[model samples]
Target: MLVDFSAPVAASPAEAEAAAVSAEQVGYDGFGAAETKHDVFTTLALVARATERITLQSGIAVAFARNPMTVAVLANDLQLISEGRFRLGLGSQVKPHIERRFAMPWSRPAARMEEFVAAIRAIWHAWATGERLLFRGEFYKHTLMTEFFDPGPNPHGNPPVELAAVGERMTAVAGRVADGLLVHPLTSVAYLTERILPTVREARGGGLDDFTLGLSAMV
Candidate 1:
């Protein structure tokens, strides 16, 4: 079953690792860590190194904050360390949050996210095959990769890339492109049965195995 090891809040890296270890010991299938004021990627890396059996996941790392290539590199490393138990959950926060708070560019979030996923997969393919990155998209363009920057080959395959989406457009995109879609806590059961599920099914042609539906609730 899916599980969230911790909420999206600020915490020391050590604490996050400890939490992941404890969750693994408790027999959780997957442990998710969220993003907030703290550094989610660093925490995820630490957790991957600390836990042995548990699958480590970033509930929703803000996509606009970093380039997709960097995320791919880090995710590949984390997957290697965790024995291929890394889930890269991506989310594009509000435009205002990206531009005003994170000081990052925000335009056409859905389109940017589409390009971002493509770029990440391209980078992973390049690293896996030892080929030069020549990805060109409307938003992202990768030209070269030197020895110093190239991560070489990944021991494990590329990590699973999930997307957290709430709106209809984002949900449709997630179903079409993302490995999985994380359902937010605010969504009700009715919404899932009627709205979200139908939209995702339409996008994915009703193939249940090709998509994963994640939900959060009070236990």
Candidate 2:
């Protein structure tokens, strides 16, 4: 289990960096940032620069707000900057937030999120292996990658992608594709055993040796 620190709303970047440093000194395994008034990536970037050993993650960055290409670039850059200590945690916000807050399209969320993850992985694969960029999904398509644009492979390899899910469909998608699952804080143990675990097991063919389960709980 990894302990992570989330920066509060009123906290500045400097304060957040200090908190992350303190968390690391106190034996926390990771530091995370939520996409609230302050951007998640920016906060984590600060933490990444300030802390050398602790892992950095975006607790729940909105996926629809940015395209897969943009996400791949940011994650790759952060992975390099953090020396492979970054995990990209993404979430599909509810319809109102997607349409109104992000001013982005709202459709089949689970399907779109699955494609989003796939597209990002495909982009990373293209960069790491020098493969042709040819990922075509229902919601996204990418088939162009020039040497001028490619970042090439990093010394630490590609960053892992974690998906935040509450519903069974999304959970199944995460089980099928994501490296990890970020459980909603409101979830109960009973719900986890009865609904989430079973769905993920079915999706994963009864194997979860490499899958990480992350939960955030209130005191």
Give one clash count per candidate, in the order shown.
0, 0
Candidate 1: give its CA RMSD in angstroms. Answer: 1.7
Per-residue lDDT value at 67 in model 2: 94
Best candidate (score: TM-score): 2
Highest lDDT against the true fold, candidate:
2
Off by over 4 Å in 2: none
lDDT of each: 0.83, 0.90
**Candidate 1 residue lDDT tens string, 58-148:** 8878889889877887788888888888888999989888999989998888888988998999888888788888999999998888878
The RMSD of every model to the true structure, in order and in angstroms, is 1.7, 1.1
TM-score of 1: 0.93
